[model samples]
Target chain A: MIHLLKQQWWKYTAVIILLYVLIGGMLVPLGPSALSLYPVSIPSDTSVNFTITGYHTHFEDAKDLQVWFKPTTGTQFYKADSIVPIINSTVRIVFHMPKSNLANKHSENYDLVVNDSIDGTLTTVYAMTVAAGTGESSPAVTPANQPEVNQLKFKAFAFPFQKILFQTIRNTFFHVPMWFAMMFLLIFSLVYSILYLRTGKIEYDILASQAVATALLFGVLGLATGMMWATYTWGQPWPNDPKLNGAAIGVIIYLAYIVLRGSLSDEIQKAKISAVYNVFAIVIFTLFIFVIPRLKTVDSLHPGNGGNPAFGKYDMDNHLRMFFYPAVIGWALLGFWIMSVRVRIKLLQHKKSLL
Target chain B: MRKLLCFIIVIFTVLYTSAQSAEPIPSLMESNLKIYVVVGVLTIIFSGIIIFLLSMDRRLKKLEEGH
Candidate 1:
């Protein structure tokens, strides 16, 4: 029993880690969230009543919740006169907007930074903008900007629930890891193909073919998951974006590789031709995914591509990072486990056929 | 129990985030809006294929036993 356990440790680990992600990814409550500020566009030099609504924010127990309006151009955030709570998640703050000289030249955008003990410090950019207005003659108002509040607290493990990706963000665990698994499996197949060309081992050929078959399965799943994610979040199952098209093309190229292998009757001829084809397909696949998407002038729906801010900028917050890394590893290991089973079955079949 | 929690989260998200029905982001799949229904159908199809494959494997194992 111990000997069996020793050899199959990774199989157990994969199951356990996946169980953790399945539970932790969903049950983990999102940290205190601040969604938006009402009437985003506020006229300058007026004590305007701003309504701030948050999601899962603790306004009641907050010891200190300070609000500041930081102009995009300048470091200084002109402060509000007073902050009042209408509800736990909603706050009405009267911002004594000041007449600024910068407003004349350019419509300077202001970010709303809310610092609280409960939700930590969160900022929403372009929350309000001091519209570039005519140089006005007005009495000077007290623009007492509150100092930046330091909110450092030990946060619990959770997934980030953004506005666009609110519920669908959970798909991150399932969808993204499929691609990661596919890439690993495909790369393994590519390596095996290369090894077969070097040593001309029938074993290498079997492994290579099995790996490709598994990779194809993973790739199809990856595409499906991505399409599902796109359907809900991006309001489409498939978008005509360059990256999406390139990925589809890459999958088709691999499918062709599978078909080409199956068509040949002679084993040596099939192995030699297919192995060479695999090398060429991988090179094209690499260029299709890595090179083509980047050179696209048209914008992409996916982040980190086509002018959109990368996940590093903001989308993948620390909380999501906690589960995300584990999710990737779990899926990769699971893919390997399935692939190993298939390989064993194939080897058995190959052995039987030789009899 | 885990599935229950996940289901609840999905429901909660659908209910709450639906309030944020503002600008619909650009989508090419808008032409084939029925594609929203495709995922469920695909799932059923895949599940059937898997069951069939499992049965085939069992049959293959029997064939190997005779050898």
Candidate 2:
């Protein structure tokens, strides 16, 4: 097991995988999306002209342009009467609402969909609200005209253009992997601590300390990256968030572990006490990070906590998954490599002190 | 250390060519507007890794001198 730590192959593999993640995560462009629409609400049985702003859409170059409003509740699509391209990223769409459009439902919000050959399909949810009309007729439901944009000739491999996230979505490859790597390293150290308690070997103690130290580095990096991303997207470097506070607490707990080690003079006593403390610290750390933030009463802005969908289910598609999984493995391997080096150094120092 | 540098350079060269080939007309203006945020993020992570490695190197050097 110790020999595996000194192996050169996994270190090279870690470097290679990380390079791939950095290149692929950064360089890929974002997919086309409808950014916004002017004058969101419209009464039924009236013509409304909407000016839609798009991101990364080629409206000027598109020969086949189709625009429509899809209701959240119904399958009936309200197709645009006239579509005019104002610029490459802007379009003017006119939609005629049928008489008594709100007979079935008193209120409905329409999702705006713009489809073209070049950029494929772009949609903005809840772009327009249709209220009850004065007309005394039944709601006319138009049949769906599924556009032939499905057979797209060119589709770029790109990240999903999330509304607030934008380019900061690339931080997923870096920031998320840090926490994951930290988790793996801390778990590894926990196991080593257990082994040390069972067998009373100083090597196990050395491994545990080195792994915790490496995990602490990763934890600090995670906090820094998260702060930067939060500053840009959430408009605050540190929000009053449960998950953030939990992470801070977890870091402090590990820091106390380090302090405890530094103060102790006797090697065996230090090892014994610290190993026992490691078991206790990890349990509390796990509870703070994984359990507390996810509690029903605790509201957290971080995803996968407090009723929010995790990146895996909603934001991350196959394109992101391809790189994200490998990134986790790469960062974890790199953390292990660093920890192994520290373990070797500690062992060498121990031997020298004995001599 | 020299081998590692060589490996990184080779990978980056390949990445550059592939990126250019993938998108013929790279949208510089749009990328410049927001891509710098990603650049900043990468910088922070890379610097953190570099500093950690450098500190380890210093520790090793001190140990070697003692020996």
Top TM-score: which candidate number? 2
Error at A17, model 1, angstroms:
1.7
Which candidate has the top score in lDDT? 2
User: Which tens-of-lDDT digit does each residue in A147-246 have in candidate 2?
Assistant: 4444552377888888778888888899999999999999999999999999999999999998998999999899888887787778788999988998
Chain A TM-scores, candidates in order: 0.82, 0.84
Interface RMSD of predicted model 1: 5.9
lDDT of 1 by residue, A275-294 (tens): 89988988898887767666
| Model 2, CA-based lDDT | 0.84
Q: Scored by CA lDDT, what does every candidate get?
A: 0.71, 0.84
**What is the lDDT for A27 in model 1?**
70
